[model samples]
Structures are given as structure tokens and as C-alpha cells.
Target: MSGLLFAALIVATPFLLQAVSPGDANWGKLSEISQAYGAVSVPLSAAALAGVVASLAYQARQTRIAQEDAHRSTHRELILLALASPALRPCWEPPFVPMTSAEWERIAFTNLIMSGWENAFRLGSLSDDQLRLTLRGHFSGAPARMHWANARDSWIELVEHGTDRRARDFARITEECFQAAVLAGPGVQAADYFIPEPTNGAGGGGS
Candidate 1:
């Protein structure tokens, strides 16, 4: 039986038994028996009730603490993931380009997109073509993409076209994207899409 119910029974049994007892002409003996049972039942019931309440409260507190810890752990993992990403590094360092409001907006949007892409890749839901298409859409008509593409064309042009610091910054962003694609896990087939196949003696080559 449940502890609460058992405690209730302990408290009630003495009174119930007393009520049903055949009373003698003498009231003293009856009073003595009643007092003896009452003394045991009252303390037992109170102790049982206190124990049940304390156990319940402790369990609730533990559950709350576990949930809070899990939330903090997940948050910490996400921060680590962001730091491991190559894209955010340039923004943190100096010869700092003061990003205009528009540039910052684009950077934020791109980072958000990259995060989603990484998650999708990890979950085995992203395709190379889809990744390429999404990137193309985001990069179109933006300084971010223009800067990146210019850096990819040639190191000499990259140095000549922009401030040395900006060129280095663009290189880091490009490298981060490449690294993300490679490290995105077994679900991603980034090499097929991003990396070119070595030419074979035959006309056709495969990655």
C-alpha cells in the first residue's frame, strides 16, 4: 500500500478499534488503552508524512537541476562549434575592417546560413547540389561573395585589389567554408562538389 494510505490506516485503526470495543463499566481501563495507541499512532503518522513530503521535494529539485545542466551543456557545445568554425576568426582579430551596418547584416545572415548547412549535413539531409545552390543564392550581388571570389582568383590579385588585412580576412573566410564542408561529417559529399577530380589519361575523370 502507499505510504500515505498506510499512515492514514495506522492513525485510524486505533480509534476505529476503540469505537468497536465492548466498553466495560470501568472507564479507566478504556482510557488507558486509548492513550497508549494514540501515543504510538500520532508520532508514526507524522513521521511518515514528513518523510514522503521530503522525498518528493528532493526529487523535484534534482529534476530541475538536471534540466538546467543539460541546457548549459548544449549551449557550451554550440559556442565551441562556433569558435571551431574558421569564418568568425577574422572578425575577432585586428587590422580590423570596421564592417558597415550592411556588411554586418550580411555577415550575420551568412553565418546563420552556414550553421543551418552544417546541421543539415550532420543530419544527412543536405545534398551537394542543394548546398551549392543555397550558397550561390546567398552570395549573389554581395560584397562578401565578391571579396571571396576575388581572393580565390589569385593571391597576387588578392594582395593588389584590397588592403593586405582585408585580403587575409577574405582568405580565412574562404578557408573556413572549405573546412566546414570537409568536417561536416559522413553525411556530406562535399569533395564531389567542391574539390575537382584529378585528370586521368582517359577523356573522362571521376572523383
Candidate 2:
């Protein structure tokens, strides 16, 4: 009986040792796999952060470009206003009447108001005879002979008392007229019809 038991113990010992060793090896391999995954995650996270930062920078550049475009557009509108003012007839001196620089500036300012109002009417922002009627009504009590300065002051007064809607409409019409005048060229005639004076020298005639 002792001999048979000893033989059975020897067979079972090999099987037990094999099972314990495989379990320990598997646990070690799992730990190594976990460590590798942890190492890979750090690089991926850093790459994602870089991508997010790059996207924000691109958006900021686009916003800056849009703002600059708007500023340039406003500047262009102002330039058009300057160019349109010189082309109007009331701003010009007649062949017989020579005007001083100050006189011309005053006339130009007055004409600018009239031209602005007339353009507003033509654009359908104001009625056909609205400005004319307003002026007539204001000056009805005054003398028949009125200077350009008086007309300009009266127009400015009327504008001040006018609705905010009219003011906005006038601004819009002014921009539109300026754009049209620019496209038509400096020599193109508008409603006021100012003929350009002949150039005397390389410097060109005074405005």
C-alpha cells in the first residue's frame, strides 16, 4: 500500500506545479500590457491638446480679417463721399464768378446738404417733394431772396428736428450715391451737374 501511494503522489505533483506557474506568468503579462497602454495615452492626449490650440488660432485670424475688411469698407465710403462732393454743380464757381477758397468751402457744404437730401428723395427714402416742401414751409415767412448760407442753416435745422428714421435713410442714400458716382467716373454728371473746369497746370484747378 505504501508503494502505490508514493507513485500516485509523484504524478499529481507535476500537474499542480504546472497550473501554479502558468497563472503567475499570465498575471505578469497583463501588468506589462497595462503599462504599455498607459504610456500610449500620454502622447495621444498631448497631440489632442495641440490640435485644439491650432483650431483656436485659426478662428482668431479669421475674425481679425473680417474686422479689417469692415474698416476698409468704411474708409472707402468716406473717400467716395469726398470725391462725389467735388463733382456737384453747386460746389463749382461759374465762368464769370470767381470764388475764394472759403467761399467755395461754404458753398460746397450747403450743396452737400442739398445733394444729400435730393439723393435721399430719389432713393425713395423720402417723398419726391418732401425736402422742397419742408424748405418752402420754413422760409415762407422770410424774404424771397435768400442766400445759400441761410438755406444750409435751415436745412440743418430741419434735419435736427426730423425723425431718426430719416437720418438713417439719408446716410444709406449717401453711401449709395457715392458708390454710383465712383462707378460712373469723376467726369460723370449727377443731378446737380457740375462741369469740371479746365486744368491750368500740372497741379489741376482748386476745388
Candidate 3:
């Protein structure tokens, strides 16, 4: 029970005692009432503690979701950047066809895209499955696969020279996607195994 309720009960004790024995004015009834009401406090305190724990757990879950959303937003922005910026296009550029282009522009774009992917990984924006799906878009054709195959050296280079583990992280998945693309060969299209999630339409293989 609340302190105010307990206090009110205590205040009424004198009247109860007066009524119990008007002439004797017994005070023992007041003691009994106080003990009875005080016993309710333990259960009340436990319930209050449970409520606080539940509230904190809810707040922690909300905070975790907010952070995940922020990371996902960052990843989405990176994908959208590829849409407008020629330097950051998600698909293979011209002259490369179904594979990596020897063209300087395509190489530069690949480098930039991989760097962004590394950052996204470091930020915990993309899960391994999401990253795999995102990488699938780059294997749009022979040129895309060629680009990944050709860029393998540089991806390793970044891992070797990087200060953070981000480059290493990207390199791990980069190798996986590049190998998968190579194994799939020129016949394997982006539509073959690429299904985009609705949450990130920015560079979804579907898009």
C-alpha cells in the first residue's frame, strides 16, 4: 500500500480504538491495525520492483531498435547514392558488359562501392544475408562478375593497409560474393538468385 494510505489508516486507528473500548481507551487495537496494514507493504514493494524491471526492459529494447534503424537508414542512403552518382552506381558501368570493365571509371566506382560496403558492415547496417543480396546486384552481367574478379587484389590491399577491421570485414564478404559470381559464370543473371527485401529498396537486386 502507498504511504498516504498507510498514514490514513493510522489516523483512523484512534477512532477505532475509542469505539472498541470508550472508557478504557484501549491502544492495543491501534497496534494490531498498524501491523496488519504494514504487512501489505512487502507485496506492494515486489510489484513495484517488477514494474520497474519491465519498464527498463522495454526501454532497452526500444533503444536497440532505434540504433538498428539508424544503421539501416545509413545503409539505405549509401544505396541511394549509387542511383544518382555515376561514381557510385550499383551495377556494372558501360563497356564492361557482363564482367569487370578495364575502364578507369568502373574501377573507381567499384572501389568506392566496396569502401561504402565496408563502412556499412562496420556500422552493423547490413546483415550477412542482406549484404549477400546487395552484392548480387553487382553481378548483373559478365562485366559485373569480371569487375569483382579483377578488383579482388585491391579489396585485399585495403584489408592489409586498413587501421580498422572494417576493410577486413568487407574483404571477407567481398571474396565470398566474387567467388560465387565467378562460379555462377556469365550465364547466371542477377534475377537468378537475387531477391530483394522490402526494407531496403535502394540497391535491391529487384530494383
What are the Cα lDDT values of the candidates? Answer: 0.55, 0.53, 0.67
Tens-digit lDDT track of model 1 for 81-140: 545674654554321245554454444445444545544543357655565555544443
* lDDT per residue as tens, model 2, 22-75: 655666677699899999999999999999999999898679657855874665
Residue pairs with clashing backbones, model 2 = none
TM-score of each: 0.31, 0.30, 0.39
Off by over 4 Å in 3: 1-102, 161-163, 187-207
Ranking by TM-score: 3, 1, 2
Model 2 bad stretches (over 4 Å) = 1-25, 86-207
Task: Give me the runs in candidate 1 sitting further than 4 Å from their true place.
Answer: 1-28, 88-207
Give the Cα RMSD of candidate 2: 22.2
- Report the error of model 3 at residue 14, Å: 50
Q: How should the candidates be ordered by lDDT, best one leading?
A: 3, 1, 2
Candidate with top TM-score is 3
lDDT of 3 by residue, 101-197 (tens): 2343444555556656766787788778888898876765654565566666755885779665655767777788877876776635435556776
Q: Which is the winner by TM-score between candidate 2 and candidate 3?
A: 3
Worst 10 residues of 3 by lDDT: 93-102
